[model samples]
Target chain A: MSGRSHDIPEEVQVLAGEYVLGALDEAEMLAVRRRAAADPELAAAIAAWERRLAPLADAVPPVAPPDELWARIAAAVAPVPQEAAERPPLHAPAEPLVPWARPVRPPPRRIWPWQLATAASLALAAGLAAFALLPRPVPPVEMAALTPPDAAAPGFLVTARPDGSVVLTAAAPAPVPAGRDMELWVLPKGASAPASLGVLPASGMRMVLPTPPAPGTQIMVSLEPKGGSPTGKPTGPVLYAGTFGALSP
Target chain B: MADARTADEPTALLRQVAAGDRVAFRRLYDLQAPRLYAVALRITRQGPLAADAVHDAFLQVWRNAGRFDAARGPAEAWLLGLVRYRALDIARRGGREVSADDLDLPEPADDGPDALEVLAGSRDAAALHACLRQLEAERRRLVLLAFVDGLSHSEVAERVGMPLGTVKSWIRRSLQSLRLCLEGAA
Candidate 1:
């Protein structure tokens, strides 16, 4: 047999320890991350060390972050309703409120989290409070009310325009199975098969269409795998259907 | 089993999130963000930076939840690992500002056996406690400083007044021993 062995090199294990211990410098840390990607033994060692040191976290006391922090994180993760995002941020700094006062300071070298959190939080809140006063976006050109197969009440409301822009709001979302996704499809009149739009967001809104489905097209939604269907077509049960119509508010 | 349960619930929630389940993502966020924010706060020592780290980490969680492998490690460790790395990245980039004197030094009793004992709430925690206790007091103290305080090896060396090389070797050996200890070697 060749001289290969199963044990992770002692150097690899030590680096893994240092990586999990938060002791590696940036270069070393990046090197370790890169190496672990191609080295299963090294990856396993790193995971093991992370488990060993996980308990150390119990010592640090938790600090409640700014309430606005959640909104920021949620906005980062979910697709922000495009219409809400497009409206000009209520006010421009036509005049600097305080030319000297920066809402978020560039972190000082000797930064302190509690004090900085307080200052940044106040600035954020003031900015949001002001921004909330701005007017809402112009309403969509058309609306489609999605109805479920056997239900009388509409299940969703889709607001869209001729530009292929859409905002689908689920009035009542079904329980999506853990491994499945909800997909949107559109069938313009004279098209033999429905064309795929994309996967629907589990809640809130999902935007689809590069070009608005031709006017008078029928839109349907179905459940599929988490990444949407592999065949570029819906392969699961059709859940809801709605037809586009002119509606302006 | 308790430790696995501690991680499995989040793993399941993340799975749902990978499938684009916003409700599950929010549930997972509620479950982990406090500690994550606190961890980032300690490491970055800037609230805005901490918030950035948490924001970036959860964004990755939402985007990459599909890749989490439960068999490779616990979900809590994976989630914390993401934030820890991001916070460390931020701290490293702001290296010019991180003066040694500015560190929030660990309290004298934090690494004490009693304090560590209180951490024995999960199987990994219990095993870690047993292994950590076997290290000589100084190395145990150093490990706590490096991990809990998020100190670099040089920073730990400077704080402990040891040569940088000496600190590195001692910590490496300490980690090696701890790994062996948890593997049931006496």
Candidate 2:
């Protein structure tokens, strides 16, 4: 065997360290990122250096970010609920008014059709809030009643219209505590992540969907930070849920 | 470094996050974001930029949680790495407002245990501490300034009042030495 082995050149090793150290300039940084994606040798070197220097983070003191920062992050990732698209922007920017609520996860069980009338009161109660935002009512093409798994009474009602909008009405001024916002989510059957429907207002609000939800899609309500679930899904306990079946004309 | 349990919990969370579990994603974020924010703050030295960096990093994590490979490193390190790179990108693009004159080395003694002392005590990081201690003090500080403070090569030179070439060579030599030492210790 030859005395010399094919070791990574010293130049590449140092370059990896420089990249990991955050010592590379903009052009070099971008170049490294691009190259690392396709270059296994370079990628391995970068990963190794990252592992080596990661402990240095312990040396930097942890600083708590301002509360609004999380809200912005959540809002960024949360899907633009179709309802939000049609509604005019709030006159003043809505400052998160409440502290983050403790998140409640949804039970594994599914929603049943028997609970429809049980939640009709919630839809009726939300009509006042809905009327204020939506000038006139278009007949709903599809509807789902959101009810907490633990309770027999439905807490909210959702309806889809031919115009591809979804409306949510609350049973009463949903005992939403201060500092919390109730956000809506939809988990299509067989999917892993739920998409944000948008934050529900005090009574009821109308939203336009980018496309009508498919049958067997589950609509849910989750307690979240003021803006929404920062991670783009349900971060809080799922308060209620109902399923949409085959579209009815 | 965190204990095995503490470290493993985030790894498990990342796995769940990869599987599209939002609860795990939020739990992971809650556990990691503060530290990540601080790391970004040190690099950018600007609140808004740091927040932006943290924000972008979390979004990437949400989108690419599947990329995390537990066999390679701890989840915390992987997370810190993501924010650090993002902060550096933002800091560079935004143009660092803090000049070299105002740059302060980490305080020797502050509210808690000294950072270096804490580093020394960490089981996973002890070898790194030992390896770092082997370097000359100036070289050691250069590595920390570059890695923790997110200084670029030119910026490190400006901060230490060294020429750009000398700073580059010193950093390269220091890294090589540290790498050799770490590998030997490992």
User: Against the true structure, whose TM-score is highest?
Assistant: 1
Q: Is the docking of candidate 2 incorrect, acceptable, medium or high quality?
A: acceptable
Per-residue lDDT value at B59 in model 2: 82
lDDT of 2 by residue, A1-249 (tens): 011112667787888999999899999999998998998777878878888888878887778864434434443444444666577633322223211111233223223111222232233223322332343543334677788878667887777643334666666435888898988776655555665656777676665332344456688888998877776667899888888853344
Candidate 1, superposed: residue stretches over 4 Å from native: A1-6, A80-249, B1-7, B95-115, B121-123
User: Model 1's lDDT to the true fold?
Assistant: 0.67
Candidate 1 docks at the CAPRI level of acceptable
Could you give candidate 1's per-residue lDDT for residues A1-249 as a string of tens digits?
Answer: 002212668787788899999898889889998989998888888887776677778766677765555545553444445876676632232232211111121222332322333433444334433332333332324687777888557666776532224667777877889999887776654455665655666563544332333335577888887777777566898888887653332
Question: Model 2 Cα displacement at A165 (Å)?
Answer: 25
C-alpha lDDT of all candidate models, in order: 0.67, 0.69
TM-score for chain B of each model, two decimals? 0.85, 0.88
User: Which 10 residues in a row give candidate 2 chain A its minimum summed lDDT?
Assistant: A93-102
lDDT of 1 at B28: 87
* Residue A229 in candidate 2, Cα distance off native in Å: 38
